[model samples]
Target: MIKTTFSIKDLENLSGIKAHTIRIWEKRYSLFTPERTDSNIRRYDTNALQRILNVSYLNNNGNKISAIAAMDDCQLEAEVKKHAEKGNTTNHSLQEIKLAMVNFDKNLFNRVFNTGLKELGFQGVFREILIPFLIELGHLWHSNTINVAHEHFISHLIKQKLLSHMEHVDYQPDEQHKELYILFLPQNEMHDLGLLFLNYELLSRGRETLYLGTYMTLEALEHFQNKGKKLVYITYITVDPTIKKVPKFLKQFEKNVNKNGNSDLWILGQMVAKMKDLKLNPTHKTFDSIEQLINGLETSKKLEH
Candidate 1:
């Protein structure tokens, strides 16, 4: 069996239950005590993580810890599903998916994705489950708790599913008439999954989008220029060209995009968001979230109709 071992800290991170609280639950309520390492450190298994996650979810949702402590395994599971059915299963799904990533278990990953889709639908899964999972994955990767391979395993799986969802959605000919949105990632940035999903979001909302994908330079994007069609350009600045290089990147980007006054520039992602000294091109707008940008487009679409 693939190792599903986790430390108390991992349990704390995954369940949102502090280590001290978990200890109290163990001592006072006998919440499935974990096995001790040779060093006497608590080592939690897959089932323990699942139980604590379930307990954490129920407790957060108004179920008392004492009541949860009194319940049998079946009763606890019933309680978890009872509240989980009311929605907000992303937290529970996160742990399962995390295990799937660590083990590189494709079947388990598919099951988790399918379950999320059934519970929350496509957009809900993306916003509620997938985004939070990515955040956690990033932390694990950063802390060396998980490797880049593990990160890519989960990421590629999500990418495939997102593309599948996009492909399956029916788009009318009139939807094709919507304004062209060109999406890309700036040079040296390979994280294009977010951009790809945003294409789905735009396309689903009746907007025509051309996804140029990763490692695109401003020079390369100029080809989409002067097509006599006013284009809404979108790109992400994610760990590419470095922070100090952003000013220069924007300057070069301005040289190309600024040539066309009618072309609109939209910049997204964390690198761009956190750059305090970065200068935006004269022809650019920044969005805090994809939801904000999509809502803006929806509002504009309504006004035009």
Candidate 2:
């Protein structure tokens, strides 16, 4: 059996409820019956944590604790589900997901993701919801609304989903077009889900890719360029290669890859869009959105063939 025990801190972090309030609920309404550790510490199980979250959600929306505590399991779950599904423009669903992540609630995250995917297909969920959600989460983290552990939990879950989709795609190289695109993030740039998903999108459309994952060095890339392999280097400029270093980095990249006759560099990201100093060469391009980049690639491919 999976042990569902959680420390007091875990409960607080997960539900956004104070430890004192939780204790009061436990004493006043018999809200949770957490098992005591051998040394007399309170340890909450998964069910208890879930219940507290449900109660907290209701309480936040003006439900009284006395009434919420009287609710049966089925009733509480139904209420939570209703709230989740209701088209409330003011609802902070992403914040709820963040709370779930803080508590390490894999089930909650999966439920939310799957629901969003069902309502809006993978592309829609990715573009409309997940992307915006990630950006907002980053803001929350930087503003001290959430911590690193919470951010990491959600990031890992999203990465797993992206990797699973990537694995399912086919990536056969076309002899007629023996070009291979390699995608990666530079050193200290750990955000790669967008790049990974783009790789999957390209692979699904019968394009070849050599995904280098996160934190690749410039030196390592130089060794991978082969004569027949028309190289296209793609990266998202989220972090590292800062605004100050972008001009130098692009200069070095051009110098390194210009030796290969047929090589191009494409960049997409918030930082890339904001870059004004870097003068892009004929073989270099920057796109504001993934769709724009893909469209450009398709146009380029048609022109080349």
The most accurate candidate by TM-score is: 1
What ranges in model 2 sit over 4 Å off? 1-96, 170-178, 298-305
User: How close to the true structure is residue 41 of candidate 2, measured as C-alpha lDDT?
Assistant: 96
Cα lDDT tens digits, model 1, 1-305, are 35478888777766668889989899998997789989999898877866787788788888899999898778888987777677757766776787688778899889888988787789988988887787677677666666678778889999999888888877654542445789988777887777887898877766777888887778878887767776888987767767777778777876876565677788888776677555655567888777888888778767878
Give lDDT tens digits, candidate 2, residues 63-126: 8899999998789978877776675312335545655665677897787778777777666666
Cα error, residue 265 of model 1, in Å, equals 1.9
Best by lDDT: 1
TM for candidate 1 is 0.87
Q: What's the TM-score of each model vs. the native?
A: 0.87, 0.67
Which residue pairs collide, candidate 2? Answer: none
The RMSD of every model to the true structure, in order and in angstroms, is 2.7, 7.1
